[model samples]
Target: MIAAGLGCRKGTSAETLLSALAAACAEANISRESVSVLATGEIKRHEPGMIELAERLHLPLHILDEAALKQVETRTRTVSKHSLAQTATPSLSEAAALAAAGEASELIVARLIADGATCALARSKDHS
Candidate 1:
């Protein structure tokens, strides 16, 4: 499965999230429809923009807890001090994507930051 993981500031707009997702997917050379799921840190499970984005995409939104997030932190290529301070993870987008992609997943796209939001992509180990 290919998953897109997102991280955003509180109250981020849906348009911003969409744009970020678009840019990230473009960088990874994948269509948004190819994304099997949208993933994020558990703390963002209730974020309005994220909820809206998932609904708009008609995809499941997977929420990864802190432990799940931490497990993949070292695999993330990008580090944001602000994100670390806010989410207690160096790379929420990468971590969430890797976690949702399941064991041995690898990042297909590192974190891509846009206005108020960040996005990354990962693929399951079993996927080619």
Candidate 2:
């Protein structure tokens, strides 16, 4: 399964978030339809943009708490200094996607920063 992890400002628009995800998909040469789920830190559970993104894609949004993210942060390909301070993880999007995709998942696309958001893609080898 393909999972996308996201990091965005509290009031970020869904369109902006989608644009970031699209860029990640393009970089990975994968269609958005291949994404089976969306992941983000639990701190964003109330973010409407994230809810909208998940709804629009018809995929589950898995909100991983800081603990879960921390568990997999080391697996991320890059670090976001801002994210590190905010969530105690190097890359929120990368760590989130890796955490939600399961133990055997690997990053297919590193974090792609956009205007007000960031995104990364991961695929579960167990499913692939």
Candidate 3:
């Protein structure tokens, strides 16, 4: 399964989130329908843009805690200073994607940034 992990500024619009997702997927040469899930930090569980994005995608939104995010932090290719300071993780999108993609997963796309959001893609080795 493939997962898209996202991070966005507070109060970001759903359109902005969708644009970011599209750009990231385009860079990865994958369609939006290929994404099995959306993932983000638990702190964003109630974020309007996130909620809207998941609803529009018709995919589950997996919320990862700090520990889960940290598990994949070292695997992130991109670094966001603000994300490091705010979330205590170097790359929210990459880390969250890895976390949600399940065990034995690796990042297929590094962090991609748009106007107000960031996205990364990860794919799992265990298809079963």
Cand. 1 TM to true fold: 0.96
Relative to the true structure, how large is the alpha-carbon lDDT of every model? 0.92, 0.92, 0.90
Candidate 2 clashing pairs, residues 3+ apart or interchain = none
Choose 2 or 3, whichever is better by TM-score.
Answer: 2
> How many clashes in each candidate?
0, 0, 0
Off by over 4 Å in 1: none
Worst 10 residues of 3 by lDDT: 119-128
**What TM value does model 3 have?**
0.96
What's the TM-score of each model vs. the native?
A: 0.96, 0.97, 0.96
Clashing pairs in 1: none
lDDT of 3 by residue, 49-88 (tens): 9998899878899999999999888888988998998899
lDDT of 2 by residue, 34-126 (tens): 998999998889999999989988889999999999888779999777997788899999998998899998999999999989999989889
Off by over 4 Å in 2: none
Give me the candidate number with maximum TM-score. 2
